[model samples]
Target: MKIIVIGATGRVGAQVVTKLASDKENEVFAGARTPENVPNASNVKAFKIDLHDTKDTILSELPDADALIFTAGSGGKDLLQVDLNGAVKVMIEAAKKGIDRFVMLSSRDSLTPDSFSGPNPSPLANYLIAKHFADLWLIKATNFDYTILQPTALTEKPGSGKVTLGSYSSNENSISNVAAVLAAIVQDDSTIGKIIEMSDGDMAVDDALKNLI
Candidate 1:
C-alpha cells in the first residue's frame, strides 16, 4: 500500500507515519510543510503537502498514491485554513487522482456536533465547528471508502495494544494508540464506511477492529 499521510509532522501524524512505514509492504509518503524533518528510509519518503498552498498546488504535489490518510490539523491556529479547507482540498485532489481509500483522524466532538454544534458550541467545542464540516464533507461529497476515527480527549501516556473500538466513551486516549488505529484501518477494507467512536479498553487492537465487522 502506498499511503500518503497529511500533517505528517504533527504529533499524532508523525507517529502514524512511523507506524505505517514500519511495515515493509507499505510505502509511505510523509506529507508535511517541513519535508526535511521526515526520515529518508527505503519505504518512507518525505513529500511536500502545504495546506497553506492553493488546492491545485497541493494536488500537484501528490504522487500516484493508493491511499490518503489525513491526520492534519491547525491545532487552534488556523482552523479554517488547515483543519477544514486544507483537509477538504486534499480530499478533492485525491479524488481527482483516483485515490479511493481514506482514513481521517477526527474528534469525538464531531460525532455530536449538534449537541456541540454551531460556530462556537459549548461544553465540548474544541475544534467542533471545523471538524463537523470536514468530516461531513468526506461522508457526503466523496466516493472514497472512508473510515473516520473519532477519539475523545487525548492523553500523553503510551496506551496499551488493547482498546475498545466502538460506541464507547472515556476520559482520554493515547496519541500513539490513535495512530495505531489509523495504521491498521487504512489497510482494512472491513473498516470502510464506518465512523468508529473509539476509546481505551481491554480488547486487543486487531481483535477490536475485527469485532467491528
Candidate 2:
C-alpha cells in the first residue's frame, strides 16, 4: 500500500510515519512543509506540502497515493484556515485523485455533547469546532473510504500497545498508541466509514479495532 501522511513532522504524525514505514509492504510519503526534517527510513519518502497552499499546488504533489492520513493542525493559530479549510481542501484533492481510504486524526471533545455547552466550555473549543466541520465534510461530501479516529487528550508516553475502542473513561491516549491504531486501521477494511473514539486500555490495538461496529 502507498500512503500519504500530511503533517508528518508533528508529534503523532511523525510516529504514524515511523510505524507505517517500518512495514516492508507499505510505501509512505511523509508530507510536511520542511520535508528535509521528516524521519529517515527506507520505505519513507519526505515530500513538501503546506496546508496553507493552494488546492492545485497540494494536489500536484500527491502522486500515485492509495490512501491519505490527515493529522495536520495549526497549533491554535489560524484554526479556520489550516485546520478547517486546509483539511477539507486536501480531502477534496485526494478524492479527485481517486485515493480510496482517508483516515483523520480528530479530537474526542469535538464529538462529546457537554464539551461545547457546559458553563466552563473547553478552552480549545475553537479548535475542536474546526475539526468538527472538517470531519463532517469528509463524511458527507467525499466519496472515499473514511475512518475518523477521535482520541482524547494525547500524551507522549510510550504506548502500552493496548487500547479501547468506542469509549473510555480516562480520556487520555498515548501518541504511540494512536500511531499504532492509525497504522493498523489503514490496512483493515472493517474500519471503513466508521468513526471510533479511542483511549489507552487493556485490549490490543488490532483486537480493539476488529471489534468495532
Report lDDT (CA) for all predictions.
0.88, 0.90
All candidates' TM-scores? Answer: 0.94, 0.96
**Residue 111 accuracy (lDDT) in model 1:** 61
Q: Give the lDDT of residue 83 in candidate 2.
A: 90
**Cα displacement (Å) at residue 175, model 2:** 0.4
What ranges in model 2 sit over 4 Å off?
A: 112-114
Model 2: clashing residue pairs? none
Pick the TM-score winner: 2
Give the clash count for model 2: 0
Relative to the true structure, candidate 1 reaches a TM of 0.94
Question: lDDT tens digits, residues 105-158, model 1?
Answer: 998868675757567566546577788899999999999999999987777898
- What lDDT is reached at residue 189 by model 1? 92
